[model samples]
Target: MGSDRTPIFLCAALLLLLVVGLFIPNWLVFLFTISMAKGLVVLGLILLMRTGLVSFGQGLYYCLGGYIVGISGQHWGITDVALVFLLVVLAATLLSSILGLLLCRYREIFFAMLTMAFSMILYGILVKSEKLGSTDGFIIAQATLFGWQPEVEASGTWIFALAVIITLVALLVMHLYFRSPMGFGGEAIRENEIRVEYLGVSPRRLIYIKYVVAAVLAAFGGAITAVAAGHVDPEMAFWATSGEFVFIALLGGTLHVAAPLVGAFLIEIIRTIALDLAPYTWQMILGGSLLLIIFFLPKGLWSLLPKRREEEGL
Candidate 1:
C-alpha cells in the first residue's frame, strides 16, 4: 500500500488544484485548461522528437481536429461531446495516416520541410474558406457531457476535467506504447535506421506508425483546445503555431512525460503575465526568455532540476 500511494497522492493533489481552481471564480481555471491543451500537442511533438523526427507540421492535424469538431457540431447538428471527440479521433487518425505515408519517406530537414508544407497548405485553404468562416473562424455552440447539461459557467471546469482525463489516458497509452515492441522498434529506428534495418525491422514502417500516432495525439489536443477556446481559425494550422508546439516541447525537454505539460503551463503563465504587465514588449520578453533558455540550457528546464539533484547527490 505504501508503495502504491504515489499515484493516489498525485491524484489527490490534482483534485485539490481543481477544487481550488473552481473556487477562484475567474479565468485561472480556463487559463490552466488552455495550457493543458497546448501541452498535449507539445507532448506529442516531444514523442516524435524522441524518435529523432522533428515534425514541423503538427499543426495540420491540430487544425484538422479543431475544424472537424467545430464544423460538425456547428453545421451537422451534432452536439454530443463524446461523439464529437470520437469523430475527431477517427478523422485525425485517417488524415494523419494518409499524410504520414508520404511524409515518413523523408528524413531530417526534408521531413521537416515536407510537414511544414502540408501544414501551410492547410492554413491557406482555411484562410480562403468562406464557408468555414475564413480568418474570422467559427464559434462552437455548446457541448454536452453525456446526459448532463454542464452550465456555461462550468465550461472551464468541465474542459479542465476533460484535459486532465485526456492527459492521463494519453500518458498511459504512450507509456505502454513506448514499452511495447513496436515502440522499441521505433526508438531503435530513431537511433539508427540502418541498424534497425539490419535487424529485420522496417524503419519506414516504424517511422510511419510513429508519425501517425503523433498526428492522432496532436489532433486530439487540437479538438479539445477548440472546444475550450470556443473557436477555431486558420491560424491553428499555421507554421508559426506548429513552431509554438515545438518550442514548448524543447522548453520542457523530451526526457519525461510531464515535461511538456509543465512547459506548457509555465510558458502560458509567463505569456499571460507578460502580456498583462508589458503589453508593448511581450513578444520581445517571451522571445528573449526562449533564447536564453536555448542558449543556457539546451535540454530545457527539466534538465536544471535533474542537474541540481545530481549536484546535491555528489
Candidate 2:
C-alpha cells in the first residue's frame, strides 16, 4: 500500500511546491529552481551508485548541456527554451553513447578517474577557446517558453514551475525504473557480477545503459540550470561540481527516489548559512556536517525516517 501511494504522494508534494513558489520571494524561487536542477544531477549519481559505481565527472555532461544551450542561443540564434533542451539531450545522448562504449569496460577507481579525465579535458578545451569566453565563460540569453516571453520579475515563477513539473516527471520515471528488470539487474550486478553473467545478463551492457541514462539526466539538469542562472561558465564541468552531486546523493541515501531533492535543498540552505557565517571556512563546516551525518546516520538523512512496517513483515 505504501509503495502504491508513493507516486500519488510525490505528485501532491510537487503540486504544493509549485503553488508555494507563487508566494515566495523571487530570490528564493530562483534558489529552489537551481536546487531542483542540481537534484536531477544527484538523482543520476544515485542511479550509478546503486550499481556500485561512482562518477567523478558527471559535470562533463552538465557543462555540455549548459554550453550547448548557451551556444544555441548566442551563436545559432535559437531562443526557444524547449528546443534548446531537446538539443542538449540529443548532444548528451550522442556523446555518452560513444563515451559509454569505452567507459563501461572499466569499474571502481578506473571508471571514476577516466570520467574525471574526460571532464577535465573538456574544461581545458573550453578554457583555451577565446570565443567561448575562456575561463570566464559566456552569458546565456533570456529564454522564451513556447512563444511566451516573461517579464524579468515573473521569469523566476515560470522557471520554478517548469522545474517542479520536470522534477516530478523525472521522479516518477526513475521510481518506475528502479523497480524494473534492468534496475534489479543493477542491484544484482552490484552484489555479484559473475552470478549475473552466469544468468546470461552482461553487466557491461547494464552499466552502459545506466551511464547513458545518467548522462541524459545530468544534461537535463545542466540545461535547466543554465536557463535559471542566465549564464554558463566552465566551472560547471569542474570536478568540484561533480563532487557536490555525489555528496548530495550520499547525503540523501539511495533508498528513496525523492531523497536527492530533499538533500539538495537542505545542503543548499546549509551552505548558504555557512557561507554567510564563515566565508573563508564554509567548506570546513560543510565537511564537518557531513562527517556528523556519516557517523550518526550511516544510511544517510533518509534513514532518519521510520522504516515501513511492511518491510519488517509487520
TM-score of 2: 0.96
What is the C-alpha local distance difference test score of each model?
A: 0.82, 0.90
| Number of the top-ranking candidate, with TM-score as the measure | 2
lDDT of 2 by residue, 1-314 (tens): 34567789899999999999999888789889988999999888889999999999999999999999999999998979888889999999999999999999999999999999999999999999999999999999889988888998787889889899989999999988987789888888889999999999999999999999999999999999999999999999999999889989888898888999988998888888899999999989888988898788878898888877643442
**How many residue pairs clash in each candidate at the backbone level?**
0, 0
- TM-score, each model? 0.91, 0.96
User: Could you tell me which 10 consecutive residues in candidate 2 have the lowest summed lDDT?
Assistant: 305-314
lDDT of 2 at 283: 88
Segments in model 2 whose C-alpha atoms lie over 4 Å from true places: 1-3, 309-314
Please state the error at residue 66 of candidate 1 in Å. 0.9
Q: Which 10 residues in a row give candidate 1 its minimum summed lDDT?
A: 1-10
